[model samples]
Target: MTDGLYPQLADAFPALASEIAELLRADGEPLAEAVADLPYYGPCTCTATCINLLTAPHGSSGSSMIQLERDGMDVI
Candidate 1:
């Protein structure tokens, strides 16, 4: 549960969805089908190397801060 999902953000930031999809694709992930509708409680409040966005996984995986991984094999 979060304030909202990525779709709402995507609607506001036109290029956001495709950009994320492209990143996921480049990382050997399929066409954004999995995380396309993930909810975000808010941005991370830490100093990690990420966009500072916090996402909650549905089950035991718990929560994590989202990072845009690149080049050296990106994985969620």
Candidate 2:
């Protein structure tokens, strides 16, 4: 869990991080491992549905963004 990829994601939501790795592994173990090694930039600014991983910094424009939800709502 300390390969250093997605450290923030792993530290914040370990389960979600593991699930992402598992999902990626569906394509190939190497692919998953490789992606896991890529840096997790930060959250997205748009309201589009996604895992919330970005590759570059995009400053917010007062738009809503969701991370982990709990009880059907955003929690973190």
Candidate 3:
């Protein structure tokens, strides 16, 4: 429902729509919701590399937990 990909896929691949839905759902949660809180970098439109989150800290553990770990770091 978030985007037309689902319906478009459903139309093209009726038999595999359910499986594709599962992949997009991200373990029962909407894909958008799962990634909404993550940070974003520049689009970098001039080059092949576009916008992307620094995923090193935002894995399954979640952003807040990763922020906590970063906060503990002490630089001299």
What is the C-alpha lDDT profile of model 3 across 1-76, one tens digit per residue? 2242222333444444444344445335464243432233213344466433232233334434211112345210
Which model, 1 or 2, shows the larger TM-score? 1
Which candidate do you rate higher for lDDT, 2 or 3?
2
What are the clashing pairs of model 1?
Answer: 44-52
**Per lDDT, what order, best first?**
1, 2, 3
Candidate 3: misplaced stretches above 4 Å?
A: 1-7, 23-26, 32-76
Please give the lDDT score for candidate 1: 0.53
- Per-prediction TM-score, please? 0.45, 0.43, 0.25
Candidate 3 Cα deviation (angstroms), residue 51: 25
lDDT of each: 0.53, 0.53, 0.35
Q: Where does candidate 1 stray beyond 4 Å?
A: 1-14, 47-50, 57-76
Tens-digit lDDT track for model 2 on 1-76? Answer: 3345445555565675666666556535454454334445577757777545563346534354324443565433
Q: Is candidate 1 or candidate 3 better by TM-score?
A: 1
Instruction: Report how far residue 7 has shifted in candidate 2, in Å.
Output: 4.6
